[model samples]
Target: MVTPDLTTSVAGIDFKNPILTASGTFGYGLEFTDFLDLNRLGGLVTKGLSAKPRKGNPPARVVETPAGMLNAIGLQNIGVPVFLEEKLPKLRAYDTKVIANVFGATEVAYVEACEMLGEAEGVAGIELNVSCPNTEEGGMIFGTDPAALGHVIRICREATKLPLIVKLSPNVTDIQLMARCARDAGADAISLVNTFVGMAIDVERRRPVLANVCGGLSGPAIRPLAVWMTWQVHQAVEIPIIGIGGIMNARDVVEFLLAGASAVQVGTASFVTPSASANIVTELEDWLSERKITSVRELIGGLELPPRG
Candidate 1:
């Protein structure tokens, strides 16, 4: 039998495979060189980059939950200029694609970061971390408000010629509306279910587990919701979708594909096993070959449903 093909294209960029490491969990991609060959995976998204470096939140920023974890790291990073000057050059040596994740507290900040990354080399695309709050708008999250979401995407869309992928926030009443907003505003592709808003408490101390009081929830816990949103967004827009949630193995990756994702990102799983993303790339190939699946693309939106009674 011929080897299964895992290659996929999103937002006009060709990926060797469908598995790219999620932003914060994967660090700068160079950090994992000792654990796995970076060239083996489809791509890697750098930590959230802003116009300037941030000190992030104080201590107690993360906590492990039942089947997942909650984090409010405050999008800390070395800033856009520093990443371009220091990291991008080193990453250019690897054969894999490098996607930069951009974050901002306001619309202007978003555009600034996009412009900076747009001028840099070795970046295949820009994934907008719109899940951030819009300080200019009284802290309204750009991803939750349809109008705000569209505005930020439109300006950033104009700021960069590279592919623009808007990562959606799940804490909203209408996810499909948000997806449509992203597409109509000129997003090249969409990545869904950034993280569910959640919080944990210490019964004895009677205080929030994370210093930020509330944090984003990620892991297998959000997989079902993520898949459902992926399917909903698939029906809402024509652009490609990169599904994200509790994907621990190839089967989980297959679940998102069947639901309507051209590709998927591995987030929390990387924390459990540094090589989780690379392992999934190989496991996905093995999974398809065992079933005689010629190309992984065949699984996209292949979910079957019962006919109406």
Candidate 2:
């Protein structure tokens, strides 16, 4: 019997499999130690980090929706120094790939964060969370503006030798333009669509449900939109893409890969079941084996579109 190959290389880094835990969803990659063997997974993306530790938003930061959930965690993290000093040593013990998710309020901050992560020993790659607002640009998110996004990526590129993956926001008008801009700026890969801005109100209390008022939405609700955007960006650029949004199971991962994602990230699903990522990895292999597929890579960009009338 042939063993189905799940290995995939993105931005020059080899992944044991195509299923990785998305940033901000997998915590620091150590929290799930009790739930599943971290070594069994493909890779893990850490929570977004900054130069300084953050307290995050006020309570009521998370609220459950019908088919999804909204969160305004404000990118709370232990900062880079602590991560390097405390977390990295522990994360290094795992056989799985560890990619640090970096974010900042300014382009300089982004560069600095990337430089710090680049020098870190345990990290396999650096994922730039360009979804944060560019404080120097009058509070516009870097991912929302192609020029600004390009500038940030260029500076970060100069700052790090580690493979760079830019996480794009879905709030923008044209995701393809932004993906192209990142590629032009020397990005090795791309990940999208970072949670869509959404809100829920408490009519009974006549107030916003979340403390942050508006927050990023995730879960099964956004799967279709994510697949669509991933397909659009796939058509627009040649760089590898890490599809994310609402991946909940093996089927969801297949949809993204078929739509042209080289890999897929499991986010909200982890929140429901801590072992979701590890489970999906096994499920993917099983699904492929059942279909007589020898390699998961064969599913990449395999979607067949109908002829135009």
Candidate 3:
């Protein structure tokens, strides 16, 4: 079988492939070591980490929907100090690239979080989770307003030399405007469709299924919308775009790449299969090889649009 080259560069950081474990879905990337070779995949994005340890939201935080899942985990994490002192050392031993997913309620909090990750060794990049719908104050607030989004991006840009990948929120009127804002503010790259706001209820009890009442919806249910949004952002910005939101198999990854995504993140699928990310990497290679494609780059933004009427 012909070996197709899967390595791709995003925001100056070179990844072995375009597959990355989405933040929040994959714990610290080390948890799955027993299930899959951590280095066999592209990269690992740590769960959303805050300036300080967060207790997260109350119990009953997750619920299964029709074709997706809703989660209001509230960015629960071990905080930066513990992550650097404990997780970083172990992650550095692996050959895979590690990207820290940072979040905060205030601009200072965001800057501080990035600054902490910036000083940590073995971190290939930083993915600002500015659109987390689970948070009470910050999260989506920093991602919705153009001015506020620009402000946060600008602040974090100065806080870290690591590739700054701004993960965007889908809960907005114009995601294109926000994409442009991140690019104009000096973001190295951007990831999109952080999970659409959704909710579920126990009809018999007349109460919300999730303790938070509302949470972010993810999985196949949002793939179509995610692809559309990724395409729109691709048209609006120049920086590398990492597509997120219901990607499941190798074919789904191709759809995102055709829509102009430099890479793609697998989230909810990980919950279904521990080795989903690594398996997708293999599937992608096989698919490319079968078509005599030498590299994944050829398919990036290669979607052929129908001629205008």
Each candidate structure's TM-score, on Cα atoms with residue i matched to residue i, is 0.97, 0.97, 0.98
The C-alpha stretches of model 1 lying farther than 4 A from their native spots are 132-140
Once fitted onto the true fold, the runs of candidate 2 whose alpha carbons sit more than 4 angstroms away are 132-140
- Candidate 3 runs further than 4 Å off: none
- Tens-place lDDT per residue, model 3, 1-309, is 779999898999999999999999999988998889988879999999988998889989998899999999988899998999989999999999899999998999999999877757799999998898987754689899899999999989998888999999999999999999999998999999899999899999999999999999999999999999999999998899999989889999999999999999999999999999999999999999999999999988999999999
Model 2 per-residue lDDT at 14: 94
After best superposition, candidate 1 residue 225: deviation in angstroms? 0.9
Q: Backbone clash tally for model 2?
A: 0
Top candidate, metric TM-score: 3
Sliding window of 10 residues with minimal summed lDDT for model 2: 132-141
Per-residue lDDT of model 2, residues 268-291, tens digit only: 999999999999999999999999
Question: What is the number of backbone collisions in each predicted candidate, taken in the order shown?
Answer: 0, 0, 0
Clashing pairs in 3: none
Give the top-scoring candidate (lDDT).
3
Better of 1 and 2 by lDDT: 1
